[model samples]
Target: MVVREDSVETKHEAIELVLARLLRLGSLVAAALLAVGLTAMVVGLTGIAPRLITAGLLVLLGTPVLRVAAAALIFVRERDWYFAFFCAVVLAALATGILLGRAGG
Candidate 1:
């Protein structure tokens, strides 16, 4: 019974390790997409290149955001309210920056 309940600190660490592994895999896939996109662009495949590039960029950009989110969830589950609050703030800031940058560009 007692053994069935996992502690928060250890859970946080385990989640982080999994996220790290996922991030690496995501990076590899993103790179492949980028390469294919660029190759298609060079070969004048009009419809596919930009889409592939966009997909790659989305994956790259989203990975960190996902990391923050996962951390936030873990923090919440652990009842680490302060860290969870800060994570929310960081996410808001990041979203605002992305929105502003897109609008400005």
Candidate 2:
């Protein structure tokens, strides 16, 4: 059976959607790794336990910060409103986390 033109277009769109999601997910993972690696390095350099623990917590909680920051940069460059909104919310959460973590510390 021959595939219709509309069917091909729909398939192509679906593939693009999947690719975009994968790219975003990959970005999030990479950002998490970067934050974790940076924290680990700082912990290794400094022999302070509480500071190290704080850094670890910050890295863990800041994963989304990196993710959103990456997305925000992309959205800003591309002028994407919806993604920008997502970035705003994620950044707000990151800010809240920072405030709470500081207070607790």
Candidate 3:
């Protein structure tokens, strides 16, 4: 079986497009949640506003991590060891930072 260069490039482009869309969707959702939360707060619905804001912030923070995980999965599926390894390292670092931040706090 032979894989052509153009096909590989196409696959790469498709993967990038998927990732880009994921990021854009995440950002939009987070922004919407934040906006609603703030509006709720201004309208005096304080009880649920904070929770909504926190959720939005969490989603914003997790977006990049999710993107990395998705990329890692895609790379692993495509048998791209180098990119997969780098993604793993980045994930580890992100995890470590979160852990350290929590511990310090």
Candidate 4:
């Protein structure tokens, strides 16, 4: 099975495009949520404002994790074991940190 150089480049480019779009959409949604939350707070809709702000912050924080997961999936699909393994390791570390933080907190 001959994997052409151009095909490899195309795959990488596609991965990058997908990742970029993911990040952009995540950021836009988080920003919109945050803005709306702030506006609601200013308008005295205190009941839901904090929840909205928290949701926005959680989305912002989760974006990078999602990016890593996406990259891992892409690499796995491409049969790029090295990068897929690296992504898995990073995800494991992130999960460990989160668990430890929660336990300590």
Q: Kindly report which residue stretches of model 4 are placed more than 4 angstroms away from their true locations once superposed.
A: 1-3, 11-13
The TM-score values for the models, in the order shown, are 0.71, 0.40, 0.86, 0.90
Best by lDDT: 4
CA lDDT for candidate 3 = 0.91
How do the candidates rank by TM-score, highest first?
4, 3, 1, 2
Top-scoring candidate (TM-score): 4
Q: Supply the global lDDT for candidate 4.
A: 0.93
Q: Which wins on TM-score, candidate 1 or candidate 2?
A: 1
Q: Give the lowest summed-lDDT range of ten residues in model 4.
A: 1-10
Off-target runs (Cα >4 Å) in candidate 3 are 1-3, 11-13
Candidate 2 residues lying further than 4 Å off, grouped into runs, are 1-63
Candidates 3 and 4 compared by lDDT, better number: 4
**Alpha-carbon runs more than 4 Å astray in model 1:** 1-6, 9-13, 42-44, 100-105
Task: Tell how far residue 7 is off in model 4, in angstroms.
Answer: 1.5
Tens digits of lDDT, candidate 3, 1-105: 256646766666667887999899999999999999999999999999999999999999899999999999988877779999999999999999999999999
Better of 1 and 3 by TM-score: 3
TM-score of 2: 0.40
Alpha-carbon error at 68 in model 4, in Å?
0.4
Clashes of each: 0, 0, 0, 0
What's the CA error at residue 41 for candidate 2, in Å? 14
**Shift of residue 14 alpha carbon in model 2, Å:** 14
Candidate 4 lDDT over residue span 35-64, tens digit each? 999999999999999999999999999999
